[model samples]
Target: MLFAPLSELYGRTRIYHIANVGFIAFLIGCALAPTLNALIIFRFLSGVFGSCPVTNGGGSISDMIIQQHRGAAMAGFSIGPLLGPIIGPVVGGIVAERLSWRWVFWVLVILSSLLSLVFLAFSRETYAPVLLQRKTDRLRRENINNNINNNAAALLRSKLDAGLTPRELFLRAILRPFKLLVFSPICAICNVFVGIAYGYLYIMFTSITPLFEQQYGFDGVRAGLAFLGLGVGSMLGVAYFSSASDRYIKKKAKEAGDLAADDDDGDGEEGMVRRRPSVGAIKPEYRLPPLRLGAVLLPVGLFIYGWTAQYKVHWIVPIIGTTIMGSLQLYLVDTFTIYAASALAANSVVRSLLGAVLPLAGGPMYEKLGLGWGNSLLAFIAVALIPVPWLFMRYGEFLRKRFAIENL
Candidate 1:
């Protein structure tokens, strides 16, 4: 949320540069911290800084690519974060075993520093508002010396005046995601599924260590290799579905015709039909098919993992199940990123708030219910919510029309 808003307010290039620098600093701090508390604080700060890519990646794709091409672009971005959770622990296990846990932070510092430098050297601004603002600023400056018509200057001055104060903008940014959560049924349902998937992931992460050690009798390093299944699954899912999302959207837009307007943009005119395909023709349903497939597979994977683990099935069985779960989970994350961005374009702040808070509830949910039933319970809940995407796909136009969110 902060990154997106900042990208709009300032510029994507500047915020990207600033965020990378801050990420490097926080990573170094994490490496240097003597106490666990300091390490936690630094990690949180690092997350705040690191969130730049996650938040802005969607908007960046939206800005740079036309709607027809955004799915593949988004899919490419999804690969990194989806694979991180799986890969991080595996790498950390090796580093900690060879050196100490502190080396985990040190390793991250070195890696993040290198990436930061690379980004600093190559990244460019992509947000349209920021780009336009820069153009406006440059034009105004050039026109200032001439006694020529100051139309651009007047426009810039008006824009600056019409802009919300920092406080109001900040509040709007923060609350918009939440408003989407409360009001948008599509967002609310997706949040529940996404939140559960996240919680299940962490629970699996925490529980796998013990399960592998106790039941399979593997050491930390060997046990951590099990995560490879999830990593591989996630990678494959992103490769497969990310492109699928874009294709699906394009296909739907063609079928729905050019009259389909986005709820986020209020430019649909019944008679303004164009024979050619355009970004405006795309609908939110393009984002849903992948999510629907994910929703179905997610629960089935959980049920398999839970029951198989409960019965002391072969390690490979649970691992296979987990791989499936991981793939579905990553797909959910990718879909939600696009969904939230599309559903609440101007109110991304609220989406970020939901993103942050929803996962907090997952830890406790798993703790009270052991792996099998805990996941099963989640699966059942997911099943209940499966109708959401379908509802939105069939009737979303009416809902958008009724609520007039297109105008908001």
Candidate 2:
């Protein structure tokens, strides 16, 4: 909420800088927290501020990267969140065992602080509106006393003034994403599959420790290493899909005659038609292809990981299976996030709300069912949702036509 609105208001660079500083401060607060309550407070605040990257990273990518290159950029940006869970616990466990839990926060505080300073020193403003505003400011100051014609400056000034106030801007920023998520069937269905995939990922992360330590007789540090598979898989997925998505979009655009000529204004509507691939086309099914592949692999991985670990089969078997699952999971997330961003161009808020809620619910679901069964159940649900993206991708344009949301 804060990220999207602030990015539009103060610009992405400003928000990124400010949020990083807040993140460092909150980390320090967590380090020095004297009580559980204080720690929780600091952690929650850090999460609120830390959300800046998750919320605006896509928008930032969209701002600078053309549709053809956004997939790769998004994939690269997505690495942090994907790897954090795996890396955080390993480092935390080691630091806590060798030093203390306080040191964990202390270390993070120092690192985050250093990174924040670096970003502040070097990060450039990427939001076009903000950059344009800066130019407009310079122009006004230069022409304050001149009677020379300045239509461009006058028009830009009017536009800047007509821009939404901070309060109204923030309200619309927060509400619009929700409105899209609620009304856009394409967004809604894809969000469900993405949400489930994410929820299961978290569930698996929590469950892995017990499964490894108790079942395999691995110690704490060794058990933590199991997460390395997830990290590796995530990185591989990002590297592959990031570039793949961009190429796929470009290829589809060319096939659809949406590719604009060099001298053209780049305002043509050709590519939008290809955004949802035709059912009979030789083109890859952009929306559902990743989801369908992930859906099939996720359950298979779960079954293999669960039953093998349950029966004390070789550790390598489960590891291999989980690795495949992890990679596919990351791919699913990257694809859906990009898809949602594209479909709900102006409404990112709703995408994030659902993103936030699904993870919270995953814990409860896992707690009620044992790890093996819980994951298996999630996989089963994923199977049902696999076709949702396919349906949307095939019929989405028609739905959009009937609903006439473009006018809205």
Candidate 3:
């Protein structure tokens, strides 16, 4: 959460590169740990450093891409993170079996370091304020010895900003996400719904192995391969939402006419869309459609997966359910992310906390209720959450106005 705000002040590329380097160093520490305690500590530290991208990557996308194209860009950005787990276990099993457990960390270190270095070398500054600050500095330096008139100098200086004191800006940056969660009903409500969805995803991740192992009598490699079905579904979801979200936003903005005008100035401002009434106006509600689709799919997919697996039907049957769930989850997550880019740290923390806590209950739930009832409990939760997005879609603007959520 803290890192998300810093990215705005310092620029995304710099913060990302620094965080990546920290992640690499921590991975190395994990690889060379002297004891189990050391390894666990290092692992936790590494996750902290690794969170920078998850927290700020959306803001960076908003900085660089226009609203119309942002969905596709975000979809492309999300693929690697979402797909990594599905692919990792397949390769990890081989590495742990053929080499050693330590080599897994070493492999991640090498891959991560290479990617981080590539990004550091190639990525440009995307934060608008930082870019404008740099521009202002250069202009000040270049015109130091010029014979420009007083009016021209005053005009140039007027273009420079003097908005916030350093301390005030820092305080706002750190506290804004939390403030949004507390004050903005939309943010709070969406956080709960999406947080549960994210948590369910983690529970599914842990359950996949046991589901395949006990039910199908699969070995390690085969059990790991089961995740591929979910992976394929996630990719398909990404492909669909990548284009569909943008198209939906455009269509809705066009229909709403002036009512949906974007709050962003045409200048390069972080998290702000450029004004182009000709193309269409933009509104926060435009993000709710994909979320609605997800709300429906979540329960349907869970029920299907639970019942089919309980009946010991064909493995393909369960995979079909997983694909539906996975795709819908991706769409919903991506939509929430783009919609609330500025509050990403709070959103991410909520999701991560739910992800950790929910899985602890999954095993017991399944054990006590059996597969059918265990998953039905989750489906019930999803069903109850369906109204959340709908309410937000219908009355989000009213709530924003009522609460006075400025610049949202």
Candidate 4:
């Protein structure tokens, strides 16, 4: 939350560098800590720094990818984080067999360091405003040296600079995610919906280990095999969503175009006047239908997994449930264009809060309610949130323009 907005104020590469360095430092702390308290603190700090990539990735995609291709690009980017929880246990199980718990952090530290080096060597600044700022500087120097004043860059420079002090600009930058959360109905509600989705995901992940161990009598490296279902499910979700997402959006866009063409006379049934799209050429709401399908299926998946796990039914059934849930996520980036990073940051703030705290309830909740009822509770909440996607797809464009974030 605090750091994500700085990328827009500074540059994506600079923020990446900061996050990479901090991630390595705190991860090393986690690796070296002798006490559990110290380890927890270091882990917390590491997570704060580690989130930069996911938060800023949407912004980077907005800078580089065209609208039509972003669905595929976003899916590719999304698969890593979604798979991380499911895959982490597998790697951790292997590392724990041969090495201490600290070695897990050590492994991540080594990988993060190597990735940082590559980023330092090759990653270019992708923020358009930041690039413009650089060009404006060059233009200013050239004009100063050559006695050529009032260049075209000046107008843009003025608009960007806005005579704000650095402190004011920083405040504005940091506050934007919160502003969107507070003021933008789309951001707030979508984030709440995302929070519920993420909370359930964490609940399932946390609960699965013990459930598998108790029900299947799995232990040692074999226990890690339980998470294989989640991994397979994540991959399946990735493939299905990536291939179908763009196709669905294009279909919506074509339908919209046809409607506009038919509305050439600006008539509606009886005396009702049709509300033409007031946002961009392709409404962002076009991206909502698939997400709606995902949302509806998510609860259904949880119900299946919960009952199957409770009954100690065939192991594959719960896995199929996770597959459904995984497909339902990757929600934020698909919704916004320019402020994708801020949008994601807003979603992440709520998501991380629920993700962290909700799982604390998992052990107790499961103990009391048992697997079936506990999961049913979560599923029930999800079912209630099903209306979010439907309403957003219906009226999101109106809300987006009504609460548009201007000139930040």
lDDT value for candidate 4? 0.77
Error of 3 at 331 (Å): 1.5
* Shift of residue 10 alpha carbon in model 4, Å: 2.2
Give the clashing pairs for model 4: none
Task: Write candidate 1's Cα lDDT for 1-408 as tens digits.
Answer: 567656667778788889888887888888889899998999999988998877777777777887677767877787787678778878989999999988897888888788878887888887655566677667667766543435654555575444677677656666666566666665666666566666667667766776677767889898899888788778778776777887788778777664443433446764553465565557656677877777777778788877787677888998888888888766677676666475434323444454455456545665687667877886797688677767777886666556444311
- Is candidate 3 or 4 superior in TM-score? 3
Candidate 2 lDDT over 1-408, as tens digits, reads 557777888889888888888888898899899999999999999988897877788888878886567667877887887888888878888888899999998998888888878888888888777787788678668766444326665665575454566788778766765666677765666666666667667766777787789889988878888888788778777766765666666677667554333425456656533343342332334534555566677778777776677678988877776787787766677676666454433333444455566667655765687556766786687677656656766886676557545422
Clashes of each: 6, 4, 0, 0
- TM value for model 3: 0.89
What are the per-residue Cα lDDT tens digits for candidate 4 across 285-389?
Answer: 766666767778788988998999899888878777777776676543344322244576677778889889999999999999998998899889888877887
- The candidate that wins on TM-score is 3
Error of 1 at 203 (Å): 2.3
Off by over 4 Å in 3: 141-162, 256-280, 406-408
Q: Provide the TM-score for each candidate, comma-separated.
A: 0.85, 0.85, 0.89, 0.88
The most accurate candidate by lDDT is 3
Candidate with more favorable, higher TM-score: 2 or 3: 3
Give the number of colliding residue pairs in candidate 2: 4
Find the 10 residues in a row with the least total lDDT in model 2.
273-282
lDDT of each: 0.71, 0.71, 0.81, 0.77
lDDT of 3 by residue, 67-176 (tens): 87888898888887678877888788778878998999999999998898789789999877777666656666877645553445555546543477666677777887
Better candidate by TM-score, 2 or 4: 4
